[model samples]
Target: MRIALNARILQAPRTGIGHYVAELSQALSCDAQLELDFFHGWGWSRQLPAAALPGYNKWTTLAKQVPGAYSLRRQLDQYRFTRGVSRHAADLYHEPSLWPLEFAGPMVMTLHDLTHVHYPQTQPRDRLAEIDRRVGPAVERARFILADSQFVANEIRQHYGVAAERIKVAPLGYAERFRPREAHALRACLAQFGLQPGGYLLCVGTLEPRKNLAQALRAHALLPEALRRRFPLLIAGMPGWRDANLAPELQKALASGAVRLLGYQPDEALAELLAGARMLLFPSLYEGFGLPVLEAMASGVPVLLTARTSLQEVAGPAGVYLEPGDDQGWCAAIQRLLGDQPEWQARRTVGLQRAQEFSWKRCASITASVYRQALE
Candidate 1:
């Protein structure tokens, strides 16, 4: 079958969704039966992990710089998409991000999360509304819907009233890059950031409202004076959404010398930090799939996370669950994980084994199956 994938998320320095697209696309590279064409709505200024596909095509003006995001602009940019997409004609177009927009051909969509629905304040207004207002009915445009988890599948049904049969859970997986790193090598990489191995509790994600960064920072500041000295709190990933509100709060925690804001560390350096950290503190308010939590688990690090949200479904019993917005509760959980050795080791081993069951190849195979299902 000819399959056209929406490659917009793969166009930049990959974050959560970007990494998902990159690894899954690369996993499809070895398959010969599938005619895979990536729809690059704009010029290819950025690099994707996959080698150049013989069928890949791009718009002369590039979708990134295109002015018509909603109408003529987006359509004109992806005009090639309407012209069948590949040599055999696309059996289905797969938009890997939330909504599959304006595809000329029959399509399937992967709704990664409904954070936009449940936590509207965390996203820009227009983007948030478009998902529910448009994509809900737009499900009829595609042959089927692929959700990252059963949590998200339920969410799609709850928010859109779409039938459960329309959604299938194809839970995501961690990249091969996220794994254990050598201690000395990890230490060297940390030194460049003026950080020391095993000296910090790590949290990875954009500094956005849903990530619950403000509460996490306050919790780090409020931890027992003695415990604070033992492990610094490190926040990684890029600054995104309502980040201005988080700046002053982060500054106060940083001044205490109990927190380090390492914005957007490279994936390799990030893997090392994960490898050697005391533990991962993931207090996200919501998630479709908590990739970092799994990445930490894959690297054999004990993880502290919120018991609510879709994260619980991903981390299982391996995660140390705490109340979502409780600062004192976060502090208490961090302490118990760091100060108690027996509890920490037991959770860490379980997390590592849980991580082993997830992989990109599996994600890709499932994705391919979704495309075929869309066609049938």
Candidate 2:
């Protein structure tokens, strides 16, 4: 089968969706029966000049200032990239993001989440409008839909009225790079960030409202002063919309240097960074599937995630779940992890075993099956 995948997400630095595209593309390409083409819509540009490739953090801010920017980009992508897809006459096109462009062949779309629909204010107004206009129609048109988790599958059917039979659940996977590494082997890189193995608390995600970073920061701030000092909070990812609207306690925590924002580390460094952390803190308000939680578990780190959206589905028995507003409860849980070695060790062991259940190869196989089903 010939498959054309929307690879536009790869133009920027990888976040959850970008990693999904990159890893899944590589795995899908390995299939003997499949001929795969990645469509990034670079628009006749031979190569992006070094200066033009801005960092992910800067790109996020730039992408928001212009209204209809995404709609315009997709139109251009349709004009330029679709011609080649037409020439190839691919059997199916897989969109790893929420929506698909106009295509004559059968289409498959991966719906990562409905965060914009549920928490509209958390998204930029223009982007939210664009998603509202495009995603629903695309869901209706798709031959088959791929969801990141069962929770997301239900959300699509309930909210968009997509038929349950047409939607397939294909959980996302962690890359080989997200595994645990020896402390000594990773010490030098960890030292660059002043992070010691099993010492600092880590939070990985864009600095967005839906990630509920403000609340996580508050909970970390409320940690006993001694614990806060010992397990400094480290945040990794680029800023998202309205990131400046932090709570007073979160602001104080940031000012006091108890919370460090290490913006958008490269994917290569993530596993080592995750391995060095004492525990992963992910109190997201909602998620399609919490990739960071799985990454942390895969790295053999105990994780504390909110029991929101699809997180519990992904975390299973490996996560310490809490309500997003439970500052006192979150702090108490952190205290136990800090003080109780036996509890930490048990969770870490369970996390590693659970992490084994997911992989990019498995995700690709299921995705491939979805493509075939779409053709039928």
Candidate of highest TM-score: 2
How far in Å is the alpha carbon of 65 misplaced in model 1?
13
Worst 10 residues of 2 by lDDT: 43-52
After superposition, candidate 2 runs with Cα above 4 Å error: 43-63
Model 2 clashing residue pairs (backbone): none
Residue-level lDDT of model 2, residues 47-92, one tens digit each, is 2222213565575576689877767877888887778787777899
Error of 1 at 86 (Å): 6.0
lDDT of 1 by residue, 223-275 (tens): 88877877888889877867888879887778888888888887788888888
CA shift at 243, candidate 2, in angstroms?
Answer: 0.7
Compute the lDDT for candidate 1: 0.75
Clashes of 1: 3
lDDT of each: 0.75, 0.84
**lDDT at position 163, candidate 2:** 85
